[model samples]
Target chain A: MKRKVFVASSIAAALAGCAKITNGLNEWQPAQPILNSAETLNQAIIGTRGTARLYRPGDVTLDYPVNSLDTPHQPEYLSLIESDFTTYRLPVGGLVDHPQTFTLRQLRALATLDQITRHDCVEGWSVVGAWRGLSLGSFLKLVRPKPEARYVVFYSYDHDQSGQQFYGSLNMAQAVHPQTMLALDLNGKPIDAAHGAPVRLRVPTQLGYKSTKWIRNIALVSNFKDIFGGQGGYWEDAGYAWYAGI
Target chain B: MDATAGSSAPLPRARSSEAGVVVRRHSLVTRTTHWVVFIAMIVLTMSGLQIFNAAPYLDASDKSDPARRVLSLDGRTTPAGSVGVTTILGHELTTTHLLGYTDDGQGGETARGFPGWITFPGYQDLAGGRRWHFFFGWVLVLAGAVYLIWGIGRGELSLLILRPSDLPKLWPMQAYYLRLRKEPPDHGKYNPLQKAGYTLVLFVLTPFVIVTGLVLAPGFDAVAQPIVWLLGGRQFARTWHFVAMLAFIGFFFGHVFLVVATGFVNNMRSMILGTYRLGKHEGTGP
Candidate 1:
């Protein structure tokens, strides 16, 4: 009886350990912050001021894969798409000194930059395409964000099977990076529905997921602690790296 | 029949004639790092396969093209049913129930790059895979760093480093393994072939895998761009990473075979307990 009990307890303890490990697989740990910081520092060490033209134009993949293509049938998104996104207004609010809601036309009127860059997906595929839009740095200058605003959160209309909406955010350094853009056009044409039509966050220096699509709201926030899932982005909430520079 | 002159350093003469004497074979640090690296590699390799399932293709250029792809896994539907296909170097193979399609750890079969049994978590979870991969990746790097520093500081690296003079003894060692020679020539501490294998894995394959992996990281791209260019490009680096993984797997199998063939119990004891019972003969190994 003693030996049997000991064996039973050992099996139970092993099962408990396995459960803990599985649960901790996606658990938010303190080391993530340190890792993110280290990654950011590595980028800085390489002097990637985001000015370097990385990919050649000839290498651009004309037929870029459209990810997160499942459009939410939300009423707001449906109405916006019906209007051809013409009446769409991007509200930039929260920790910014000057709150503004710019129409697509107004966004187009801002200082725009067109560059052919590589889009590296986290899944190990790379696609090169030309993106035309206002440089996020120039757009930030116009918005005049408060010094306390450390992150720019872009809200999307897409969601997962669990009905959780898709969203992503970038730190102030990444938000103001020269290659970061609020893209209005892809492949020298107006953005199509499959590719985040009205506006998309195009961050060439990071993974493709960091570049959110169908951006409806832009909020400057001090931190992402109170945000949905509190992990900075949909994929990040699902346990991907928030920095995503890799 | 006798020890090769061009082999490594001289071995200590056995003091016993019957029951072999026990001797210290490994340091505490060596044993610790060896086990740590062994565990970390298993986790990294499985999780890496899980991550690879996300794209299931290896390209040779900056962008993925059908023509330039080195390896690809795809699914197809025929009148018979859906079948998983794996293509490599222009040759196609139906890898149904395995490579391109397999169980999802649930009863249901799914289309994936590698089989579920071989993947970490044994399901489709790229996000989870990346988390496991990065965490263990750091563990491997730290363990590797400790081992490297300790090896260099203690001059243990010389035991694995092959010299020009050791080349002649490699064939004799191979012949011993093939049973073409009756007695294994003494090669002190490590045989010439063992030295060559360890040197290739430590100094060549491991570093190549690491550099290629670093090249895949976008944050490190700026610094690693020149290295990437020298190796062809980003996609080539990615392909080479997978190739290096295969080579590591091959080395692992060969290493295990040798451990078992030469002296399983003694070798295991030496690695685990830091001590080995030497054979009656002075030149006999652990």
Candidate 2:
């Protein structure tokens, strides 16, 4: 009888003790602050300061159009031949046999290729699009790297005024992959400025950011440690996983 | 001897007080179902942890080396065929690729299936998780159903579910509780707070967990498309599933505390044996 009483009282007391949050109405709150001020300021500058360029499929025409800004996805690929943006320059420097800058017409002069692939994002989203551009391998062949060159880094005109280059890197193995193309067209039409126009890197097997839209400069490096944030890409340096593969 | 008989009559009355009062509380079925839930909660929480450890969120230093390999996160090949993989600090590949498979004659190549045996340093593949999770899930659901049925039959459901009176009493009871000035509210089989929690777990959280889990079924996606859409998306469903796990963890600890607080031995015995010690009765006759 005593044991039974002890057990009943003890268990009841235990159940009662489980009620910890006496007030349940006010506990729910946001997990973290919505935005940081510094990040918002940086984003505002990057958003407004770029000239949009349009790129079309199978069109290898590159022009050096002097534009005030070169932001991503500017929907300017269609009116390229008529737009005030007339000149396009491909800057090739850093660890190369020939540090030569090429006109848009010069880039278009190379063998062009097109591929349809999916662009996956780390935030659990994807889109299928067609891309047209010169083979990065062919371009690398033009400006041969010295034996020490191990990685190719692409810099974009999309940058903060602070000279922090928005960049991405690829090992030589992937740079030479047959399908790797520097696309100037998207979705069977001229690449929209809202998308990377002029030219962008399309790496089918990786996430969207790896594609590095609105590319402006190419640098050959022996190692990746010297780059900003040293993680390989712009978004990567800003807390995104560098290899955001599906 | 006639005088001795009179003395014996008084002894019966004193004996009644010593024996204490008996309260018929939890039914046998209720007791059984409660234990089943207790066991299931323990197993589920432990297994869930093992699964979470398989894929953790990335940190800054995690972008360098060692950590990335351990986390099994690598870069996807771009359409350009460029493979830009990240090397995080502390992410070194010690184990061979365990989750990879090569497709067999379908559209693409298949890889080896996950090893069936339980071993450390091996990936906890979806197969193993599904096996244990599904098996225990059935047990949990069945036990819950039985509990509900038994509760209704015994009219214990009314006692366990909150009534209109419980709302007004909830605040005062809570204040008394926070101050530790009053013992637990004494009414029927369960207090208002206990009823509310159990009801929420049964009606809201558990059902959502079970339904979302079903949506993850491979071929069942087509059939469960409506549910998936209603929940926003598959990823959203997964997020809710994780959130539900947190709720269950809270419920589990709370349940244990209540068990220990309310006459541990007596409650445990009643749950296991379906009997409570008899106490003195002031007015009622047995």
- Compared with the true structure, the alpha-carbon lDDT of candidate 2 equals 0.53
TM-score of chain B of 2: 0.63
Q: Which digits, one per residue and each the tens of the lDDT, describe model 2 over residues A16-123?
A: 332221111012223111212222332332222211111233322222122223563223333452463356677888889988888766766773786654343433
Best by TM-score: 1
Candidate 2 off by > 4 Å: A1-246, B1-20, B52-123, B180-186, B277-286
Query: Per-residue CA lDDT of candidate 1, range A1-246, in tens?
Result: 999999987965554454344434435476455434544444455433434236767777889888774866788888988998888999999899899999988998983788887777899887888889989988987779999999999999887777888999998888888888999998888888789988999887788999999998999999999999999999888778776877
Candidate 2 residue lDDT tens string, B1-286: 2211221131122222333544444555777788897766654553443333333222222011222222233323447542323223454432222222321112222232221111111233322332334445666878999988876765667666777877776675576558754544444445567667877888888898777654433223333446756765444454456567779888878877877875688767767765455332211111
Q: Is the docking of candidate 1 incorrect, acceptable, medium or high quality?
A: acceptable
Cα lDDT for residue B3, candidate 1: 26
C-alpha displacement of A68 in model 2, angstroms?
46
Cand. 2 TM to true fold: 0.40
